[model samples]
Target: MPPSGPPTRPPTDDAGARADAYATAPLLNCLLREVAQPLDGTDEPRVYRLPSGERLLRVRGVRRPARPEVSVDGDWRPVGHAELVKLVAEELQAHTGLSNPELPAEMTDSRDAVAALLTARDGATSPEDPYRRSEQSLLTGHPYHPAPKARGGGPVARWLPYAPEAYAAFPLALLGVREDAVAEEGDVSALDAFGTAPPGYRLLPAHPWQLDLVGPGLTEAFADGRLIRLGTTTSDTWPTAAIRTLYAPEHDLFVKFSLDVRITNDVRRLWRHDLLSLRRTDSVVAAAAAALRTPGAWLSDRGYRTADFAFEELAVLVRDGLHDHLVPGATPLLAAALVEDFDGTLPAGLRDPDAWWTAYLGAVVPPALELFARSGVVVEAHLQNCVIAVDAAGTPVQALFRDAEGVKLLPEVSRAAGWERLVYCLVVNHLVEIAEALRESHPGLDPWPAVRGVFAHESHRLDLPEAAALLSAPTLPGKTNLLLRWTGANGADARYLPLWNPLAG
Candidate 1:
């Protein structure tokens, strides 16, 4: 891994183009999936009709749709991101017969945030290590999310310092919790190495952004000496794609904090209920990982600590780092980054796409299925949670999963529900994105055959009946993020729509 210098800023002319590209992708995704219906016999410039308002829309590309236009007054008019947001709002209001003042504002905030991120990224220095660079490179996140880049509608100054997209790394605020007021579970001993607390206190590292957000609420705790600020960490930790999680390179550890700001559907607080059940959830996944026949590993969420007074506001989770879980010589990269084309490190000149796709499916798929079938644990094997360790040749060799907070156990959810969730995460969300990237890069290559082959092979090994059904299923469940957010549904409440299954011949 070589040291990276600051990225050169693009000219003003190019900056706007880049920002539009970033902002419009998710908006178009939301529009196409939720409100617009594709027109028949369209290929070159894909066209759609917004059935609700009888408006015709057209765009150039597929994966990240661009050059949007809508037919108006007997002429096609180009819709900028702002106009697109407005169109989406109007269409949704008419289609659902429901009005939301907040979502439209969030749509604008998301666009503005993209523009700000573009400005910050210009002349910004990226992390030197490939893994760190991959983790920090997600500027246009959650391709199908309407407000993926929205930062709680905060001013740039408030959030930029902690933004992973800005290539940020900062020290955590170290706090001393009075021993009597410390609420902790499992192995939080790793925190003690950062700094020593006074005789009657325990060390608890806090994300500065979170502290800033909740500072006003904690005046009395600070005044009464239940919580003592012990200054910042001596070294800086890099913010990963999930902004709330920080990676301390020196310690090779990850710390997840409670953030009050909304990152997608949720306000990202480390809720007390989730924290209370963390140990049990993690133990189940860890045990399943330990029994894996392949090199797949689960980066365990070992423990967490927080002040009893503000448990959810101040809770911090300790997760095992990549170093220990990775195979002897493999370099780990965020799986989501591989799909996003970060650093363009994916190898070129591969004579066989089948081999590559097979290797990827081999590493990513079986573990999730095996865990579900054998251990009754449904790992959230989505791309962001999965870190694929690749060899020097950029071939995926192993898969490591994290985020115990998202894992669900058998009997908690019905077996049918568990299987549905697993297929959606593994096939729809994770593999489909990667497959599209591969197909886009290698235009002549059909990736589904390889995917189908892997499923057929794995079906014999795993006891999952859905594996067989998945092969010929006409549709798969696609999480309706746009509609879910628009309807103001609970973040955990998942509502899915049927998506055409590519695996079906």
Candidate 2:
């Protein structure tokens, strides 16, 4: 005290004491010297430029709040740095046969070292439940009210053009009867079918659009607790049309028919009426097959078969667990049911316009670039074809793509649909929808930084660096020109008037 010019006193509370300790604690900087470099490949700080033009970096020091909004006494609050180190130490000992009972005290105590271990673990392990349904159990079952889908068994029903015109069309085939002894209908609800499938078939939930076209069949199926219907599918928004859910009673199997036909004239026009456009959906099926072939995919299906669907080839998959199954991928995201209007009233995390931009550019955009490079095809990976499943940790895991019809393989790249519709669908519609959802959920969250994180995280998986270049690219503020905004545009900047879809309105 006598020697010092000023007096410094530490706070009495535990929080203040902890903070003070953190400031002076010696850190090995292992993250800088070892982990971050190998993971990131460069010394460049993980800095991202915000759309507002400010540069932001990862929240340094202190780290994300240690406390969640709510916590229970027994909950395994995110494995702390010390605990994480212990876990890593155990894993290393098991893998390397290095009996390291203790992670050198220097490493064990380092928070950065723990973080690096977590990062490496993330890269190495593919978590089982990608959709994070375990956290939000509310979304585990049907988003809508459960419908009893069991119906009285009978001969195969006729394929009516419209629900109202049911009597005109002749039966496509016997309801439970099959010409071949191999094919038989099962006694199970539509939900049961989705959970399990027969040896030569797959059952998937029909898209909302497909449900609307078939009118009450889907709702009725849901109500009856068991019934399957077939009809042509509709648009890029949903692809449930012409999809069928067939069950086999004797084999206790469920089969869903997948088609390559577009149900709408709009989608047909968008792709110039080429069957190659169907490749998007086809590619998804193909990718799943390829992924399954790799032991790493960890898929349960025994195998898949290619069958004819309206003159085009559609894939039929057979897997166990029709009644008791866990998709781990589809269950969670669909539960949230993103609200689709621009009321400017979405959540704080999603409301920020910048957040939307970042997600599209960072996470969604790079994959398109990678796909273009690998297959020579730029796919239209819009919302309809893509299923974004979030995990218990609230991280988006796998982006499951379905409905191969929207896919386009270029002639030069393979000549298909060129870049017109592909660009419009992937870049415009799909990206915009995700952006809108993000903006609505986290209004205050910055979009660009999120996108950067996505790009940084995902791009590291690909072989090509060029695909990641777009992460730093700027995005134009999006403007819609539906009929609602039309008259307003004439009052000011006439060029920007139409803001609403006239037909939809």
Considering every candidate listed, which one attains the maximal lDDT? 1
Off by over 4 Å in 1: 1-9, 347-352
Provide the lowest-lDDT 10-residue window in model 2: 143-152
Residue pairs with clashing backbones, model 1? none
What is the per-residue lDDT of model 2 for residues 437-461, given as tens digits with 9 covering 90 to 100? 4644555544445545654554566
Cα RMSD (angstroms) for every candidate in the order listed:
1.7, 23.7
Candidate 2: regions farther than 4 A off: 1-331, 339-367, 412-420, 449-505
- Per residue, candidate 1 scores C-alpha lDDT tens digits across 1-505 of 3213334555664666687788898789878987688889999799888957568899988888999999965589899988888888888888888889898888788778777877877766666788888888787888889988889998889999999988899999999999999999999899998888999999999999999999999999999999999999999998999999999999999999999998889999999999999999999889989999877899999999999999999999999988888988888888888767777545233556668778888899888788998888998888888998877666778999999998989999999898888888888889998888888888988889888877877788885677888888999998888888888899899888889999986
What TM-score does structure 2 among the candidates reach? 0.35
